[model samples]
Target: MSEKDTETVVHRLSTIRERLDAGMDRREFVRTLASAGYAVGMAQLLGVDDFLETDDGDVPVVTALARDRTDDPFSLEKRTRTVPAEWYAAVEKAFEVNEILASSRVMGYLGSAVVPGDYRSGTASVTIGVTGDSGFIGDLIGTVSDSLGLEIERFEDEEFETFEEFRDGADRSIRQPRLARDAANGTAPGGVTCETDSTMATLGPAMYDPESGSSFFVTAEHAFDDEATVVGEALTLPTETEESFDLGTVRFDHPIADIVAVEPSGRLDPINRIDTSPPSTITGQYTRWGLADLLARGEPLEKVGAMTGHTTGEIQGIDAVTCFTDNFCRHGQIRWGSEMDLIDGDSGSVSYHPDPEDPEESVLVAGFNNARTWWPGQSYVWGVSAYRVNESLGYHF
Candidate 1:
């Protein structure tokens, strides 16, 4: 409390503040200052704890706390590269991580394609990103390299290190139509009519079980709004009434699926909905397909809402702010694109990835096609995975 004592305390407190900024631990630095005649309590009152205990969890958190200064310990060097083989290796790893391809799938990453990397002496360099303590990223890299027989190089601890995007995709393909779309497009020929407007532009597909021995089918939640008004062939019949029957309104809808089921109001016939078949090869020079199959880079995959039917596309990235939007959005959404072009009636349309097992033939209904992002040509979808969809719906994949 004496004048000399107060002056001594102020000087020591100032020295502790400077050391804390220089990466000195708080408790030790405070003790050192206190031993040197500074009042530790007064230093604490100067908001020292607030300055030291900054959180560095998420990318935004790290970016916000990381100041741009000559004194920063780590350096962020700029670079770029065109390593096709390396990029392919990264993609193969991502596919294995998502279980799309087996760990032993062939490496299709031959031939150099354009890519972005950090440049060093005209050699494109991609920094090996640091995974921090999780070690999950390290495992992912090893899995990819092992599967492709390649080694990743130049790893660095960058702000966002992982190469995996939200989803995956390849070239454009034919505007194939589902049975529902065939019906919508007036090509259902013998397919029974569901008087209900089943244009599910926003909903994802759910499995359907019909009466009268109809094969299993899938459709969207918004496809059948009202069962009472539907004029489809009914399952229950009377002697005086005709053969086909009308399926009733859907009983339940999976929270995450874009599909729903309806009890027929009249006689039932198979093929009410489209066939849920898988493809053979999803990429490179095909028939009944378009450039949609040539979409390996951009979006890993996407689903198209064509006038003929629901088709799949590779989703390169979401254009919206998806990671932390309100209840209206999900995480890691890249908001904006021109690729997800479906009509108003296509709400429950099924968006998904092509099945790798039968790439050109089989498909996985990932979700319902959603809105566009800030960038044109990108689209969004939402559906429960096989793990969750079956658990809640009392069904198995």
Candidate 2:
């Protein structure tokens, strides 16, 4: 080729390189290369280094937390693993799209959740629930989906129950546990009955506040009356065999998330273990992407409510936003199991899954099971996810 022709070719290649460096979509990059007279295979080869840094053919992500020492509640560490780059990109884009939809609060929007596609498909979709079917609403969602290259599944005319309705139907009939003080460990295991003056709820797994370097006994804030926090109502641990003892006072109350942290004032400190047939130790909690991975793998979450004992159910959705029950929307919620898996007194019980790293003895908390759908057409238990709690309150399990 002549020098001028060669210079022209170099200019085209340079422009393509600049666009690639500017983070162009991989598919768009390939299309641009095709337009520039390059084969799709060659385009992929050229962009391989820009897309993913593959180790054994996968990309790395920090999925969950793990404790350096089992006994040390504060010794938390992040766990990472390489995942398929395509799947990662899909999930990441789905999260972004879901956030946009949530922030916009589209007309007729009730709530929505992200469903990550399988590794082979390399896709993700947002499942949104709305109160009515409207053409404009559909068109708006369609336009957003088209522009972002994401799928959206819409559900219309779904009914939702309020917190008051759930509280009114509370069952106080379940037999309470007789917990023995663990003087040897100097900490209390969760999955037992804890009470405010007016109501009772299941004690959740211990939560660690990294900022304060403090561990707290967490439970559903709605279990107490609205004035409980204002009146300095004490939290009590009731035993079947012995007199009930004061566990602590409410340290922090989050009404919207329906969670509260109790400052331990008694001898027993909150530990990371749950009371089960073979006790399950909470090693850490899952991240949003980690929960999505579980959903894609068809994994079930297990919880030990004070009333229901031990029950397991499949995860329905992740990174969900729910606005039906309250005046404001609650984001980063997980919908799982079924309504039967949770009951009135089951509030504050934690939904968890066995740790992927050590499934036999340790587990990772998915979220707090504070409420379940009481309306028809939907049968899943819903609550604030562990990732949301960590992000909002700076607490981790």
Estimate TM-scores for all models.
Answer: 0.34, 0.80
After superposition on all C-alphas, the RMSD of every candidate to the true structure, in Å, is: 20.7, 9.4
Q: Any idea what lDDT model 2 has? A: 0.76
Compare the candidates by lDDT and give the number of the best one.
2
lDDT of 2 by residue, 222-262 (tens): 88887635325578887655657677888888888898889
User: Which ten-residue region of model 2 has the weakest summed lDDT?
Assistant: 41-50
Candidate number achieving the greatest TM-score relative to the actual structure: 2
Off by over 4 Å in 2: 1-57, 147-162, 169-186, 228-231
Residue 73 of model 1, lDDT score: 15
